[model samples]
Target: MTPEFGSRRTAIVTGGAKRIGACFVRALAEDGWTLLIHCRESVAEAEAIAAEIGNGARVVAADLATVDGPDRVIAALEGMPPPALLVNSASLFELDSHDDFTAEAWDAHMNANARGPALLSRGFARAVPAGQGALIVNLLDAKLAQPNPDFYSYTISKMAFAGVSELMARVLAPQGIRVNAIAPSVTMVSGPQSRENFAKVHAMNALHRGVDVDDLVRALRFLVASPAITGQTIAVDGGQRFLSLPRDVQFMES
Candidate 1:
């Protein structure tokens, strides 16, 4: 983008339809940002959130698991002022242990969780003006620090993304773009997890508390306002990384 072109106070959040993604969308909106809520198939939820925020937040649709998804998301920024922030909050968290893992499932997880965010960060860096200083915050999992066999594909994909964040931070620092990540512990229910299991696992951290939407909002705000911090992952997992759980908390028997 040319220096002559000014940027908007805009942010794009992938998977901004529900869960923690939607929470970030609302938080950014409240911070006076024009939100571009990106969703794959949950367009209705995205639209609902947009309407609730009443800030003219637009919903962009793209399956990040597909080849054209990142491009499609980046294309939405065309004709509009450049976005100041890009939150790679969308992820594929399907269950596939090592014993049951398949190439198809692994590829699917990698495409959506790692490759898509990496490409989106690249596109976002290019789209930003020469010195506007943009930030890309990727959502990661705390389980990555002490990985278990549970959700093997998902864990591997996040590991790849963590590496992507570090690499991009080094390459983009001179260009005034910062790439960072946040590792959140299990805050919400996962696939097929019963309420009992969720409660039991949510407290399995050093702080005895799980990550929350407020924790994420605070972290993003700090990153957005801080100009000196880059290439670092701030763990908001309530010290979950310090513990060594043999299995993902979800699978631990009560």
Candidate 2:
């Protein structure tokens, strides 16, 4: 007999419709997880992925930048079984040179990237059953370390959330819920602007190469599966952190 959605081991993956999030959804699905994929403007893409996965896959639409978005997602998953995993993979990334930054920009970046994940993490902690091995994986960026002069707000928000990974892990670990974060360097598979951003990143890395999105998804999979690890920021960058590359290299290359 097929299990009901409530009966299956499930995960709520925010922004699981496309790109790295979609890759994460595919990985979790292969692990036999029922997916509640939360997407903002990517409803059609989310639905398409749900259909492809075809077993206990559901799509939720919400602008996580708002105050109520996290609650709405939790409501959808509440009917499911007690043991649930929450992947806080949704984030807003923008690059405004320091001089171009505005109050609206600061709030917008904080809301979507930092506040939303914190809200979701709190909700998941309360919702998932005790001793059921629940996990929350926050998708962070290596930009937190490098400090993008143009993308300060976005990077700062991510750094804040990255710090929370340890705080939540310490408290939640006793409850059988593990909280960890992944800080990826620029990935090869985003958009045109992102590609350009990554080109700069590739040159910055010690290896002078870009990283595959698949490698990041794999790290996420390991984080979700390993109960022994928690409160860690796993860098998926290809040794980029060690190298102190100059920012002027980007301007010169351009």
Candidate 3:
């Protein structure tokens, strides 16, 4: 069914063109929510996804790394109802070590992964009407809690987002807006990796398996639907958060 203009409840999903972000868009589409799917580059992919969903799913292209990007996204919705849900799923993941990390690299990661989400959430909060409720879900990494020095800049940026989630949750609660985060480990992305490597990462957790997209989708739905839950970070990491893997074990033993 097609949503009447400005009639259906809306959701803004950053980085919704691909990967886990696309999964969230699909799930919300199935639930009949109108969507504003935001992407940085992937224009063709974003358009294709909007066409596939077909319930008034519109694509907005914006580089979240820029200071004005989030405002651009909000401005694109001028005639429509403000979004009731905002999913901050767009992130940059780069491998950087302390020895090699540069100021430029750190800023790039922080701009996309941390500052972007905070600004987007701030915009979303401003759009919501008084006494009405809204939800914001920030995507995070399970390793933020564990502190992996391998992905130094990425980890630090995600940690910043985690803090953003909590601070926004408390600050916006009075406005009836709730903010929370989801941290997932070893989830498959749209990238190339050997099966052996994939299996090794999957087995790093206590459950000996990685958290799937479905697991994350369920957690997100729960957070959005649960009114009492706020300022919490749920790690859907198969118990990886509780135990640290041995440094020598890169892959599962044959």
Candidate 4:
């Protein structure tokens, strides 16, 4: 029998073309969701995922680093049912220290990681039916808990988004929309790292292990299925946030 679908069973995963974003998209798709996989440049990969899923999954390409990005995604909701799950997973992770801050870097990070998520959250809340329950999950870095100067601009933007997550939860709960975040550790090979270094860094956490795609999928599934888990930020980072690291985990033992 074919699966039943509804707006309340729909999801939009930003940056859902590759990497962790694509992982989220696949997870939700497997759990029987009508997907709107949003991508920026990785259109081919996004299309492939959509084609593979074959569940009315659409690929939306928009610059989540701009104000109009949310509009395009929201507009795609027309005629189709509004998404009940909006994963703010797109981000600009560039290197910038406190001493090297520049307007370009700041704007790019703020727009993509902070402003874009906030706008999309608002759009998602509005699209959901009044007093109908829905969930919005933000993908944040575990480093936000252990603040650092490395990736300064990216850190600041994520910090801003963290604030938005809680505040939006409080503000949107009246509409029955839940807002939460998942802060994951060094889950993937990011930035500049040799295979050896990546492996070493991955196990530096308290659990001597790294968070993985399945771990995040579990957290997201919990938030989506739970009826009373709002304003919460779940760290699936093997206790990385509990440590007092002065720099990013990758640079800690280097």
The whole-model lDDT of each prediction reads: 0.85, 0.77, 0.82, 0.85
**Which scores greater on TM-score, model 2 or model 3?**
3
Residues 1-254 of candidate 3: C-alpha lDDT, one tens digit per residue: 12221346788999999999999999988877888999999989999999999877888999998999999998877776557889999988776688999999899999999898899889888988676678899999887777657767887898888888889999998987888899888787323446667766665777777679999999988887688888999999898877764321233352
Comparing 1 with 2 on TM-score, the higher-scoring candidate is 1
Error of 4 at 132 (Å): 2.1
Estimate the Cα RMSD of every predicted model relative to the unseen true structure. 2.8, 3.6, 3.3, 2.4
Ten-residue segment with the worst summed lDDT in candidate 3? 245-254
Per-model TM-score on C-alpha atoms: 0.94, 0.89, 0.92, 0.94
Worst 10 residues of 1 by lDDT: 1-10
| Candidates ranked, most accurate by TM-score first | 4, 1, 3, 2
Count of residue pairs whose backbone atoms collide, per candidate: 0, 0, 0, 0
lDDT for 240 (candidate 2): 72
Residue-level lDDT tens digits of model 4 in 1-254:
01112333668999899999999999888888888989988999999999999778888889977889888888887765556789999989988899999999999999999998899888878888765568889999888888879999999999999999989989988877788999998888887766778887887778888788889989988887777788999998898877878888778673
The sequence of per-residue lDDT tens digits that candidate 2 reaches over residues 78-186 is: 5654546788888887666577888998899889988888888898788876546678888898756655464667767787888777789888877877888888876
How well is each residue in 146-179 modelled by candidate 1, as lDDT tens digits?
Answer: 8888999999999999999899999998988888
Higher-TM-score candidate of 2 and 4: 4
Model 2: runs farther than 4 Å from truth?
1-7, 189-204, 246-254
Candidate 4 residue spans exceeding 4 A from truth: 1-8
Lowest lDDT sum, 10 consecutive residues, model 4, at 1-10
Give model 1's TM-score versus the native structure.
0.94
